[model samples]
Target: MTGIGAKALQTRWFVRSPIPLFRAGLGFVFGGRLLLLQHLGRTSGQPRYVALETVERPATDRIIIASGFGAKAQWYRNLQADPHCRVWIGFDRNRAAIARTLTREESAAVLSRYRREHPKAYAQLASVIEEATELSIDDIPYVELHLS
Candidate 1:
């Protein structure tokens, strides 16, 4: 199957009813393997969630890149307005985090690492990253979830 097709399927299954079990299963299979991001809507104050492949710095902080599927995802924009967010890793939730938009150089570095580690997934993201790379930091927010 195509990459997008696979991701869509995964997303559909993930957001379906019985949210707890599905999320736990996802964490069991991909936790620490994936960075689960939770963002609040800029105006509506509703929560939004997405699972992203995570990269860690030498300092052991969790990092996630935007590279939104469509450059128009509301979560990305919400994060621009408010950098605070919650991150879930392996069924455990860390509610205190401050999102810091990465510089082009930083984003490129993170993307490079992600590509090296997850070639297949990264291939699917090529187009998004290409467009996202040029966007201002506010447009493509990259956040490092600091677990307290």
Candidate 2:
């Protein structure tokens, strides 16, 4: 259950079960915020995908996503290994986009603006982050996907 703490839920069967449906459903889940990032595995060199939330959309060709699980998340690491990737943005996907991890300052500014735009969701996310990691949302890292 959600109240079971972050670690337990992460390893539980129920948590993993939705992932398959998530991948299968792709962009249908959370409007355009949830996207299936298609990237390469760092060592295996195989294609991989992980659903991520689009926290900020400053421009039509650019989108920002936070590392909800921190910098050690597999998808974040994969992007560092290979900047080139595609985002399955529902109807029109952004292919061969450049994924750049934003600086701390940039992330802070982005989150500030994001909070104003999505006040209630931001508060909920902050609470979840605090519960999961015992840290503020500011501790997490973010990335900018520059589409071509």
Candidate 3:
């Protein structure tokens, strides 16, 4: 977070470089710690993809992700426009899913679990997110992808 900023977070090449690997069905390389979300564009209705860090996988069929950029993130907005989507995580690809924004209380619980389960990662993420968005972890929006 020392040198990372809002501009760095918004950099297309830096953030989206992993998407190609996910699309190629190599998501397992991420060790279940990241996922590729395939959603429809809110206005264009075209497929859009994003590689997001996995905050938690509470169940085999569910993955929780934090919108570090908050509710205004493009992927978050698109999911809100249409919850239907597909997910690629670990060795799984193209699994149908529904995205839902967790309530504040639910997000808090998930964040707590994430922090406990992955203290090092949580600390690094919290720092970068705080620097980039100027928002605390509790204020960030969390979304759950319920896979089918």
Give one clash count per candidate, in the order shown. 0, 0, 0
Clashing pairs in 2: none
Residue-wise lDDT of candidate 1 within 1-148, one digit each (tens)?
3445445534656534334543565554554666667789999888877666565543445556564533466667787788788876666655467777677677777767777887877675554344434443234545556555
Question: Once model 1 is optimally superposed onto the true structure by TM-score, how far is the C-alpha of residue 60 displaced, in angstroms?
Answer: 3.4
Ranking of models by lDDT: 3, 2, 1
Residue 107 in candidate 3 has what lDDT? 96
| Ten-residue stretch with the least lDDT total in model 3 | 1-10
Predictions ranked by TM-score, top down?
Answer: 3, 2, 1
Worst lDDT 10-window in candidate 2: 1-10
lDDT by residue (1-148, candidate 2, tens digit) is: 3345455435647434434645565555567766767789999989887766689888878989988778778889999999888776655554678999999899989999989989988887787766776667898889998888
User: Between 1 and 2, whose TM-score is larger?
Assistant: 2
Clashes of 1: 0
Which regions in candidate 1 have their CA more than 4 angstroms from the true location?
3-19, 22-26, 55-59, 127-141
Residue 4 error for model 1, in Å?
5.2
Model 1: lDDT equals: 0.60
Q: How far in Å is the alpha carbon of 107 misplaced in model 3? A: 0.5
